[model samples]
Target: MSQSPAPARRRRGNARGEQTRSVLLAAAVRAFADRGFHGTSTRDIALAADMSPAVMYAHYATKEDLLFELSLDGHRSVQVLLDAEVGRHASNTDRLRAAASCFGQWHAEFHTQARVVQYELNALTAEHLAEVTVLRRAIQGLFGDLIRAGVDEGVFQVADAEMTAMSLTSLGIDVARWYRPTGAWTPEQIGHHHGRLALRAVGVAD
Candidate 1:
C-alpha cells in the first residue's frame, strides 16, 4: 500500500517555503522602497532576493501579489501594534502617547516596508486595492477611536475627531519618507518626541 510522506519531511518543506517567501518579501520591500512599484519588475525583485526569476515566480505569481502581500502584512501589523499599545494604558492621554510613539518608531524601524505600504497603493489592482483598503481603514479607525476617546473624556480638544485622527496618522507615516538611522535622533528618541507632539496636537499639556 502507498503511504503519505513523513510529517518531518513535510514540515521541512513548509519551513523552507516560508523562508524563501520571507527573503523575497524583504527584497521586494527594498526594491519597492527605492524604486516605486511601477518602476520595479519581477526580475528586479528576483535579483534582489538572490534567486532566479523562476523561483520568485514559483512563490509569487505576479509582482502585484508580492505588493498586495506586503501592504496587507504592513497594515495588519500596525493595527495590531496600535491595539496592544493603546490597550496597555487606562487613560486616553496615556493611550495616545503610547500609540503615537509606537506608530512613529515602527515607521522608522521598518521604513522600507512602511514606504511601500504608504506609497504603492496606486499600483495595486482594483480587487487588491479593495482588500488593502479594508485593512487601511481598520488602522485609521484605531487612531480615530483614540482621538474620539480623548475628546469624550475632556482630555483632548479637537475640532473634528476624524480629521485629527488622519493628521495624527500622517505625522507617523511621513517619518518613513525621510527617517535615517544616521540622523541625530534614534528611533526611540523620535518616538518619544512624537508622543509629546501628539499630546500637544490634541490640546493636552503633555
Candidate 2:
C-alpha cells in the first residue's frame, strides 16, 4: 500500500517554527543588548519576539546559549570582514582604512548585535569566553599588524603600535553605541568619517 500524504498542518507548523526562531533571535539580540545577560529573561525575549516563553525555549535551551551564539556570530562576522579587507588591498594604509570602514559600517548596521556581543561578553562561561577571546584577539591582531606595516612603510606614525590598534578598534566599536540610522549621517558616511579620523590618529595626513 502507498504511504499517506504528509499532513498540511505539519508543514505549516515547521514554517511557523522557523519564523518564531528568527524572531526570537532578533529579539534576544535587542533585549540582551539593552539588558545584561543576567538581567534578561525568557519572558522578556519572548514578549519582544511576540512569542510565548515556551516558543522561545523551544528554539534556545537557555539564556547563556543565546548569548554564546550571538557572541560567536558577531566575532565571526568581524573576522570575515577584516580578513576580506586585508586580502583585498595591498597597501597597509588602504587595508587599515578598509578594515576600519568595514567595522564601522557593520556596527552602524547591526548596532544591537554589536552592543550585545561587546557588552554582554562577560556573561559567558569561562570556556566560552575564552573561545570568544581568541577570535577577538585575532581580529585585533589583524589591525595591529596593519598599523605596524604603516609605521614600517613610514606612511603612518604612532607612539605605540599596539595602543594605536586598540584606539582604532575602539573608535569603530563605539559607533554601535551612539550611531542612529535616522540621524544625519548614513553608515557609509559614518564609516568614511571615522576611517579618515583613524588615519589621522596614526599621523596620516588628510
TM-score result, candidate 2? 0.85
lDDT of each: 0.84, 0.80
In model 1, the worst 10-residue window by lDDT is 1-10
- Per-residue CA lDDT of model 2 for 93-193, tens digit only, reads 78888888887888887877888888787889999899999988998898899999899998998989998888888888899888887888888888788
Residue 71 of candidate 2: its Cα lDDT? 81
Question: Candidate 2: lDDT of 99?
Answer: 85
- Candidate 2 segments whose C-alpha is farther than 4 A from its true place: 1-20
The residue pairs found clashing in candidate 1 are: none
lDDT of 1 at 206: 68
Model 1 spans with C-alpha error above 4 angstroms: 1-13
The top-ranked prediction according to TM-score is 1
- Pick the lDDT winner: 1
TM accuracy, model 1: 0.91
Q: Write down the TM-score of every candidate.
A: 0.91, 0.85
Cα distance off (Å), candidate 1, residue 37: 1.2
Question: lDDT by residue for model 1 over 55-138, one digit each (tens)?
Answer: 998888999989988888887778777887888899899999998898888888877888898988999999989988997788
